[model samples]
Target: MHPRHLTVNRSRSSSTSAGSASSCGFCPQIVQGRAPLGQAVGRWSDRHRPGAVPEEGNPREHQTPSRLRSQRARPRATAGRCEQRRAPGAAEPEPDRRALRRTAARPPAEPPRRRGRRRPAGAAQLAPATHRAGAAQIPCRGARRGHRRVRHRHHGHSSGPRAYFCQNDHVTSSKTSIPRVAIYARQSVEEDQGIRQQLDDGRKHAADHGWTVVHEFSDNDTSGSKERGPKTDWARMLSAFDEDEFDTLIVTETSRLTRSLTDVLDVTPPRRAMRVIVIRQGIDTLVADFQLKLLVLVAENEVKLKAQRAARYAADRRKVGHPTSGKTPHGYRWVPAGQRDERGTRYVVDEAEAEDVRQIFREFLAGATLGQIARDLTSTGRLTRKGARWHSSTVRRVLMNPLYAALLPPAQPTGQHSMAAIDLEACTPGAWQPIVTRDDIVAARSRLVGVKPMHAGTARRWLLAGIALCGVCRKPVKSSRPVNHPTPRKDGSVAPAQRYHGYRCHFSRNGDVIDEFVSELCIQRLSQPDAVDLLTPPDDEFDLPALHTRRDALQAERKNVFALIGSDPSRLAAAQDRLEELEEQLREVDAVIAKAAERHPLADLMGVEDVRAWWESRTLARQRAIVQLLMTVVIKPVGMGHRPRRPQDVLASLEITPLI
Candidate 1:
């Protein structure tokens, strides 16, 4: 087939003379005289011929050159037709009608390469072949034609065409950064072995996951069952979490962290972004769906079960006439149950301590107050079971406990006990050896009841009502006065009036006289320029080196005990006993250190130039505190028929003992 040509006309006008028709590429001259117009004219002429004119002599003759070119461009009725060429710059000839028809009938080219794969040979062609005319090569119009092949290839596959999509850009392999982890370990009992094991397990888990262990937070002897109180290290670890110090937390198990569901939910829900890994439970909170909630519930149930079991064991032990709990009473010490069928231990009277208990009861029954008994015990260098100086409250507790009486009180009434009374007849002899007889106990109780004044009330206005002690009787001075008194009038007639009030020692000086004397003494002493130095003594120097050494030694001993705990079960009791002793000694050392570290508030007050103004500006409670810190005022009994007339005389009758 011959190449098809499309002639583009340079001239704007379509009309041309016979001479121009011979030169125009698009307007071809008819070789023979125009045949009949009907016979020469074909399909191409009917579709593309712009204008036609019939000749004057014949109907086949045409006057316009465009109509003549249109006739020559038609597809030949027979195959024997010759091809013609035209010169450049002539009127553009009509695109070869025969070439257009042949091009439309030819098949299109194949689709573009997809996903780096070659198209199959059997695939239907979709793109058009290229066509060229003169120097310019025209791309095939079939390529632009509406074909379903390209559209089907794009939308048919669910994965889409991989070649069109860059996997490196659109589809990514996730890069997971190693998470920083914090390991937390806790034990409810004072055993370092449990803590050590927890920490070891947690670290191993972290190592397996290739997580960076940033911190290890541990709490010893800290209970997880209760949500109250401070969990020192646990609190600190949470704070660290808030600061984004770690992305993951590793624990030996959930129970070590918290046994309360509320605490678990409260702590974990807000930190959903952080991962929690439990080594034993094989749970990761980050990926956990419902498992985390289930684990928390399990831990809470375990705590409840443990508590129930403990309560049952305690009740059973109490039924068997054994101490139901671990705490030893003040006069006794714990002993292993030697042939007793009780679960663990029994209480035996500590004889040396029991003697002290007997002395306390004897003194109380002999009319000594709780405070006086405490002072007496303290004077003899006796300490309580906790190894601290005795307090009046402590003495009172010992006196009140029914175990020390010949009989014990009925079991604490369940629900409510409105009718329960002190059953003196229920006294069981040899139930426990009594420290004091029933008569002595009754006498002491009767004296306590009798001493309770019918008009017992607080003294709000009296400055030293509760604090002032009678120097002679060694009892609290009561604020009192006569209800009525006679006031002398100018007419020499006496009228009733309220009497002046004062602090009274039951057997000695009047309350008014003593109050005035003490107040004036306190004001005068504090008004001195050197009063501050005299009132607040320098704190005693503490030997920190010795304290630190002692603390280190105790810590070393604790470690040694912890080491022996696993090897010797018999040694456990001894280790615990020694640890308690060491703990008390450590407390004493800590107290000394704390005292040295404290700065007295009086030190700040000392810098004031006007001491009286400073004292007056303070609250009454503060003023009383200052007075108590400085000295103790003792008012001596007045001599018979000797009344004081001067401040000096009054001062001489009183004793001021400086404390600082």
Candidate 2:
């Protein structure tokens, strides 16, 4: 195809009426016989009329002073210009006016080669519009002032491409004297460590970059082995980047921030427009380089490998039957292997603390209450490992520990209950030196039952005193009272002191001589019933018979629910959940019936004696279950001693029924 080219001139009339088409390279002409029209013919034509010019087949009779005359000369390839080279002098009689109007348009040429140095291979591509914008803003063509021009070394063949540096004005370009920086750190171990090193390096790098450390985020004791590292608070950093957190991120090294390629990629998107200066890698993300990517990959691989090795070590420990590194059991101590030489191994136990433990067991065996022991320890200047006074709970924990008994040599013990031994085996014991033998421990535990009963005034008051109500009065009451209130004194003085209390109704007693109520027995009764009922199942006749009636109804509901799932799944899901819960309950009821047949001793008893036997041998839980199923105890407020006399009218009294 022939090369395409064209020229255009906007001013070519009045000043120079001469037309020269032959000199223009793009136009070609061939002559055909043509003559000037007569005055009559010319006058009839619009070309010779007023305000008309020959250029556009119009001639202007008078020039308008206010109007600026402009002409556009369009080159045309015609039959006349192609012939009569020298004879066609005198501008070819200004070319026939009608001939130029039929001119054809020319095509544009192919674009030229790009200017300036070629960008390095593997370097990021700059948009043309961005390059244009940068060029337009640049004051000079070659380089801007205060910028250091770097002549990058060309590797491989010189014929390949020229290396270039982005003009860096690191010494200047500070609109604000604020420092721009990225802080990074990590902990190879789970505990917070080596964090200070990363911070120091980051601060130093920021200073080197002439940026102030404006904001900092750190994740101490966090490992990149899983996801997050000690220093990378990614969410906060990302938000700050969106808000333009800093001029640039200044990190000691990319690895300090992340050891994952994905994490490295995350850093760039947050502040894509902002710069990132990684000091250790010597990378300027804004400028771009292959090494930056390579370094990120290297850091990521190292993190993954470190995590793998740590995981492998953990697995190996489990295989070797060693506990994973963490807290030790209550009685045992973490014995560092280093402490073990050729001699016996040294434990991490605090000996003074361990001695107090020995005294507690001995005191318990000597008939001290756990609470009394706790108070004694506190009063006698004994402090716990935490430097706190002993609590009954803490004392009990020490007594119950089997490590003390495990220290016993294998032998039958005297007066040691087998029940205590059975309980000991249930609690897994840790390997530790025992201060007392199993026999001594059993003897200590036996004292728990034989200890002197708490006197009325000796024991502490119940926390629920005067708050928990008596079902009889529908009023709060005290469960017990001091010894002085137990019976009247023979000396004719008031039987109980004023402080010795009772559960008296505010309405009935005129707030005087309030009677102490039976509280501990009530708690023991109610709690047993509540717990047992929770464990027991409804009678099969009651539950299963009701269920059989609902089964078909539920199946129909389920079908309707399945149809609704496509249009309104949320409602359907709720219905399905209810159905599942009901089904689960039915299964539980079946399980309860099976359990009752196996464990309930009442299966063999009969009549009133059967009832008495069931009541006698049944656990508190089973008693509660039976009461809930077969009886309803209603307490109605009435005058004292007004018991229900008739069976049918069981007023102000318990109503018992066989639920079967």
Candidate 3:
């Protein structure tokens, strides 16, 4: 604590002076001066100094400063003492001329001899304004710590400026002339290498430099590489620095300050002079060759390189149908290496959650809306894997994921396209077994997104535009208006300018009439007793005898390649990759031979009593799937003049062949 102002009365008594001095020992004896105290009671700096002014007649200014007798020992500090004597080489106080007016020569008390560096002879005898104001207004050279404000007053003296003194027990040299320091430590994530260790090191370094630790700031699990994320502590440290709270900063490393070049400039602000010590990097911001900007660039490059390596590793894992290191998917939990099954996959199915996943797929494929399914699941006692309420987006995303169907999304040179572009017929199998099959997921996903985009970017309007092929070119045809140019209708209104084409076999027909004819055929077929047989798979891929022969040839070939690579590292590496691919193909063939019939589509159509109304509700994509599954529409060529005049003509030009 520093003071207000100190004053002394103009009385001339030794007892009164000694009694007032006993309050605090900084100024050993109080002044009993005869001069009236001026309005400025405390003013001592390089401009104005405290010195003796002799009376008009007596020449007491010539008195020699007192020296301690050799017999007297220097005083020692006590338990509760706050005696702060001035430093070594400071000007001794002139004996009060008023005291000398009566007694010719009374020697003053000797100040304690403190051991410390002396002020140079050229140094100003007045206050330096370095340490805070001490006794009176003369600055003390004692340590500026462990201080408390104290006041000492003499009785019977009422008219003088009141003085406050900053009292501390131990008065040594200006030992507390140390710089104020603030430590800033940060770690981007929670880990063993944390801010605690950095702060410990910063405190130790500050102690070694004789700096007073003023502020300790830390940010844990908060990134410093980018000017993103919350760094409230870092901002506060800078604010305090700018406010002149402390002039020095300490850190465990250069990168801890910042990894971004733009943010690095803020650490060593050019406008304000400051000292920043990077402990581990051995770089000081005050040094001429600090190059903080260059260090930031290096740190930034290292961060980017590390990120790229992680992404490349994850991409490689995904290429082989393994998870790319993230939250466990809803159906499974990650198992450790040795505890996993022989195939070395990390996750095992968690049945309680898997049952929920299966339910979502079943209800969604059974023509349940996303919102209805989400509400029903949310009403149950069970919770999602993340312990969250089910939502329409959550259900839709689950349906879009290929993982449940035991297939990996196809990897493009960049990222793969959206789910609508996925080839459900040629899906790549994953290491895990299926919870929902390919047909079920594809059907459910199609209902959510509707029909895939048209090849020519036209909006989908007809039920079987893409599904029904051009019989001659084997190309899918789109709906087109009968007239290329706008023509007047029966009501004298011109037809719309935009036109579309429909499925053809070198001959065109009314698209609306063709759609109606196909819908009627589908309804009549589902009305038959043999509709269930329509779910059976084609026999082309069920030829087990040929598949077995191919499998034998592939195995023999792989064995010969294996024998040639024995004991050679480079060749063995190649052979392993080759064998793995062959094994994958073999597994596929085995799966195809045992593949079950897809009955989900028929299951959806099973219980609906009103067949026409149910058919009307289906999307064009699902309707097309059903029609392609049940039959093929073949259209044959007819001459140009073969334009249909009657509804019976379209029947003559069309062919509906049922494969089952």
Candidate 4:
């Protein structure tokens, strides 16, 4: 009988099945089906008897009928199924009543046993209340008395909750309902690639996954199978990710994420801090699966292997001098590799523009500056790629460039082509023709110093301007009013006349603007004579070498006097006094000699008459120039009535001019 059915029968006739031994007598229905509960109880009585069913017969004959009936009656809804067996043939009568007394002895309850599979990594935790202590196994949903849901084991060990926050609370209180996601997509080659399709598919996946895309970073014309290069943007993306701008990063495929295991492992440092999900690789940040990790690494290794093979093929081509394809510089045009076929379409250079380049270089080498060449081009109406006038700097640069002097030969080998090719010296000729000779380029560079004016000029100043000052503000005065004025007309008609301007003090202008001004002649008188004298040196008389000789003679004489003092004691005091007098005379001579040496180097040009004559013949402008060149003019404002009377007193002692 099924364990569930037997268990059910135990519950029925609970009272009658518990006491009467005959009612509990085991039969086929009661033994294999839902046996009577009392019969099951009585079988236990014989089973424990000292001389009851012997151990020699089939152990089944000693079967405890009571136990079998009890197992069948148990509720299999919670308890496990009960096994049924045929009654033993020739079975001894139920052991004497004394055996019944011995079988009845048994423990009431036992401790509970552990249930369910030990590991949860491959299985799930069954809800508690599915079993009873050491007695029954139940399959039900709701909690039963003293039962608690337990965590399942993972890898032969129990797993504990990583964090305690409520999921609903975390989501509800978040600043945005949108979950941040970033999509990274790339292609495997620089040519007509599938990156566009990948991006489209990625967007579709994001929509299905309900991901709110914060950014879509793409690397186009780049190989997804190449390991991270100088131009890779993943590092910058990771920096942004660390700022918590995205909750997940989605790549179109595993290869797009990385082409090497090294790059794949780089994802972990970022993942340890927050959730990282690589949808294509089936990786979730919360779970660690070694098998899946190894699979991703394997895929990346395959991509790297392919890249290595391609690199080797390219290297072999370079060894054989095959010109790798890439962008050509501005001076040359790109043409396909083929001669004119039956179609009669030939790839050729624009010869006219090439000739123009040659003409530019020839002109520059013939002592024509870059500016001259540019002007020549403009006169002939030549335009650059932008359709603008040729600038001198551009012309100069072209003159210096090697490619224009002579094009590189065709069929030259280049390294794996990249942006580096643009700046490389590798170029081919015949594909394009040279416009200028090498000698012409060298000559042009030697003469070039960027177009500049030939004659450098010096600054000329307004005379007397720097020294003259505002009487009130003390700021330097400037040439103020026009001097030469219109002549007053005798016939009542005023004729226009040339007027000359001169410097004046502020007191003569803002405070009181005056028309009649002092003569420049007066300023010259105060400045010129004294300035010439101040710059002149005193006359030199004694020569420096002669003075030194005379000093040596004086010192010898002093030593002789001291010797005399030693030779004759009586005349010692008198000799010493005489020695002192001679020494004072020598010191005076030295002073005169030093002064003459210092002053003699300057040539004196302060001839008073010459200065006066020069001052008198010059115009006001010339007079002011001479005055400023000679001395500083501090205009001491005098009251109209209190002006200086004496020619000498009217002159202010002029200060020296400061060195520039």
Candidate 5:
């Protein structure tokens, strides 16, 4: 029979023959001589086990007949007692009677035999024994009782089964619980306080608390003042908190977490249920009250006070002619003044950078725009004192600084602090060498102010603007509104409508006719093989080397004037006069060079094969530039009461002045 199908038979007959032995229906049939002593005892102990009953009743009396049979089947093995067995296939009556007589001779008050270790109450004990063919051992009340005892031992524990059988039939214990923890550490500055120190402290605290460190979150060189943006590890920690990845949070200090009280109130309130331990301050947000609030307030106030003190010191130093900030101007270097003066540091000219400063001023005064100067400086791979690329704004700052003119402007304090007022015209001689004279600066400013600003709304969209001139009036032709003709409708009503867009001459001629003629004539002239040589002038036309040498000398003298003006303020007026004279001389040289250099033609500059592509790639502004560079186009009047209606007539009326 299958072990699962085996059942203990509780019922029994009222009477049985005198030499017959009673047994449980589910019990395995034991072979007489092969049954071991331990196996026999174990089987008997399971069958005759007492049932639980009320304290007022006898459990034995309430047992059924099956219980009586179980009791009779048990062997009365006493101390120093033994049992006899009959030989196989032999007459067993005499031998069985002898064994019965021996068992019956034992006193009823005799104690049972003591074996190895005693079995636990109602626990089933199995022993190695030989079994007959087709026999299976079925567990009885002992198995059920053992399971009940195990459940009672671990009544409150929920982590799987507490008792499990090993290969040797022994029970083992398993871990009940482990707490997960998250370590968070931050440092505002890496040099001020290392992130490693914070992490090490936090990890040690977690170890003391016996928490399993599941994750480490750190924000290095990040400010705790700001509450938003790119606090990468902090954001990840918050997400992990929401997911309940850890039960506790460990930090080196509360300030390392956040300096902002608002951030604390915002982030901590929701996470109040979680355990937060700050090792340095001994502050646990889980049990925190007004103390955390007070600590955050103190930290914030410290940051504010430090900022205020720094600003005040900077303003005072600036007032006394000392360089307050670390950054010096491009043309100057910071140097420590003698210990006798209260002002600690003063600026001295850096010659290489000072030359660049002078060159910038000279270029601006010599007709180069701010953007052109910036581009030229950048093309030469030069950088500012801060190791940054040259920008128009940087160049403008150099020109506008009063220090470059040997003047000390009063300090302008920023933020909430108000600074004392001082004279705007206060000149500080020998404070630092100037890079440019006041008059050269004034002349450059005058030139900038004198230039007329173009109207944004009047931007040119035509191919020719200043290039085309009216032959009769000798003035430039301009693009006009679209030419309109009257259109007759089916209802016999005439409407004024636009027919084509064209340009207008100062006198009388269609703009389209003149524009087409000029474009075709320029293209045909440019396509010629001799066009290249006709456009280029000989190199011997002007003395380029001599002019360059003179220009360099004038630049050097200008720089020298700037250096001297700081020592003697009286020389400022004379320096200004000399600057204006130097500027006039530079302009004269430039005009001569400009005339001599006007040799290369537009066609030669733009390669032959690339001409069409280059023309197509140009914007309208570039096209207008090309037109002006090549030649001057003029429109001749057709005379009074006469109008040119065809392209051929318009071509004859147009005049071309080639520069080459």
Candidate 6:
């Protein structure tokens, strides 16, 4: 087939009249009775209409406005030009419909030589669009640029075949819109990248590009690689993107926005006309060489490998009882690398904080409740390192932590009870100086017997809430009754019962009367030599139930870790190392539990000169501790057949029995 060619123009001349098919103002191709080898017509005007003409001296591929208007005349195979070979008064030659169809697309004279693979025999080689007719108007993959429109000047010649990229155009004509952008900044806990620096660079980039900064968002010490914790700014930026609040998203680096390829896919939507510019990588999602998905994949791999290395390094640190890179634990401060080798830099006791920790343990072991300790500390203006007021939960957390006892938390501890689950006896002691002794921690742990730790904050003014039991239910009695009514009188007149705090039951007695009676009996007994054994706590040994619970938790957690990170060999290996460390910790705890010992509960009061004076001087918790330890008290029910209206009635309804 002969080479197909056409001359086209973008606009029509207003002067073309009827019966003027050969008007020079119309496109030369239309005036000559043919158009390019195309079938697609541009219905809507190209967004890049008007004079965006390239400079004449520019050597780039852009076509000049004047050059686009004129087309070089090509030799035609037909017998005559539309007008020159036709009669002056003759009607225009009727277009032969069969011939127009036969030459709609002319194949190359010779098969075009292609690299690598040979073109199949008899393939239709398309003539390049706009080779001489017009400039290339390539549509952007994700850019804000507009597509071009190729229209015929004459309405009468509108039926010619139109072509819409029977093939793609290699050259692009970018028409950039004024960018309104949102800047996003992120830094991980392990990273030292300054968020301010990222923001500053983003601002500078926007200035350089003549882009407007619509908003700025940042997350410091936040991990983009991990889908955990609050990445507040990151989430807000995504929401803004979805809302179309900004046309462009600018970040200092691709990884700062996301280390996950899925997130990368979500950020850029060509249909939404959204763009992402990564400053460090010089990547624009709208550019021809955008490659963000590949970059995202590389970033994800790097983060995964980095996580694995960090986990392994932490494991090594743990093996030697050294703390890893992270926030310093309370009561401890990091020793500088200048003071020791980089690897040897370790945690040392912070005297002020350590003293506070020791005091908390000291008071807790002395029968002071967690709330009382917290209140005392608060009253003394002693707050946490973060300057937050102490709560009972905070006090309990301090008490539960094995760090004070020179022990580390598990290799992989999850949830709030991480410290509560540590087994100091089973694990290798840390190199740092301990604020509290193992014996003190063991005692504190034993005292943490109940499920509801918040109960420690309740006021214990009534001494025998746990020590005293009810005769009917055999359950512990409490002084909770409010005597709102008077006692009964046979003559229908009322006589009020002595209104003092008492155990609420039909058979009742004053709490002060009962406490006085129990105290006298306890003091009298301890005053004797035979009660010597009762002066100190019993000799006993018990395994730590928390250690067992921690072991089971670690095993379940390891299985979960495997499930989450199993695909990556580096991360999987790191998790396996953590698992081994967990096992080592468990074995150590179990061995220690097997041979552990307990401390005496009454050791503080054992040497008091006067037992009654000592008891009076103690806090309610200590007094109740002594009462629960020495004897069992029951507010027994008395029948009508028993003594009534007698002074000994208090003794009849109350039962006090010695435990030792």
Q: Which prediction has the highest lDDT against the true structure? A: 6
Model 6: per-residue Cα lDDT over 26-52, one tens digit each: 234444445432421221122225654
Q: What C-alpha lDDT values do all the predictions have?
A: 0.57, 0.46, 0.60, 0.49, 0.57, 0.62
* Candidates ranked by lDDT: 6, 3, 5, 1, 4, 2
What is the Å distance of residue 211 in model 2 from its true position? 1.5
Clashes of each: 6, 23, 9, 26, 1, 6
lDDT tens digits by residue: candidate 4, 1-660: 333234443433333322233232444345443556465556646665777754442234444544455455343343211112233352322324554354347344453456764643734333322111232111111111122323323232233322212212121112224457777877656643476676676678779978778877777666544455655667666666667676566765666766556655655533323334556667664355354457667887776687689778756554443333554433555455565344322223456566557656644433344565566567667777568887766675576555564434233243352221232124333223456554454345434434343421221133445456555666787655553446678988877765444455543321111111223344444455455555554456456567768777887887788787776789877787788888787766556553443311112234445544554543333344344444454555655434344444444422234321
- Local error of candidate 3 at residue 294 (angstroms): 5.1
Query: Using TM-score as the measure, which candidate wins?
Result: 6
What TM-score does candidate 6 get on C-alpha atoms?
Answer: 0.51
Model 1 off-target regions past 4 Å? Answer: 1-181, 196-217, 230-247, 270-274, 289-292, 303-317, 338-345, 367-371, 406-660
Candidate 3 weakest lDDT stretch, 10 residues: 1-10
Using TM-score as the measure, name the better of candidate 2 and candidate 6. 6
Tens digits of lDDT, candidate 1, 441-522: 4444433432433332231345566676777887766666645556688999987677666566644455566556666666
Better candidate number, 1 or 3, judged by lDDT = 3
lDDT of 5 at 578: 90
Q: Candidate 1 — what's its lDDT?
A: 0.57
Better model by TM-score, 2 or 4? 4
In candidate 4, what residue range of length 10 has the lowest lDDT sum? Answer: 136-145
Model 3 misplacement above 4 A: 1-258, 266-295, 311-316, 338-342, 410-429, 449-660
- Scored by lDDT, model 6 comes in at 0.62
Sort by TM-score, top down from the best: 6, 1, 4, 3, 2, 5
Write candidate 2's Cα lDDT for 64-183 as tens digits. Answer: 311211112233232232333324353443443343343343344343455568757865453222211122121111132233334333332223322334443222223324435656
What digit string (tens of lDDT, one per residue) describes model 5 on residues 382-486?
A: 777767887766666665565666666664644322211322234344355678775454444343333442321223545565457777677777777655567
Pick by TM-score: 2 or 5, better one: 2
On residues 67-158, what C-alpha lDDT tens digit does candidate 3 reach at each position? 11221222221201221233335454454455445333535665556344564686434222223334222122221223333333333333
Number of colliding residue pairs in model 3: 9
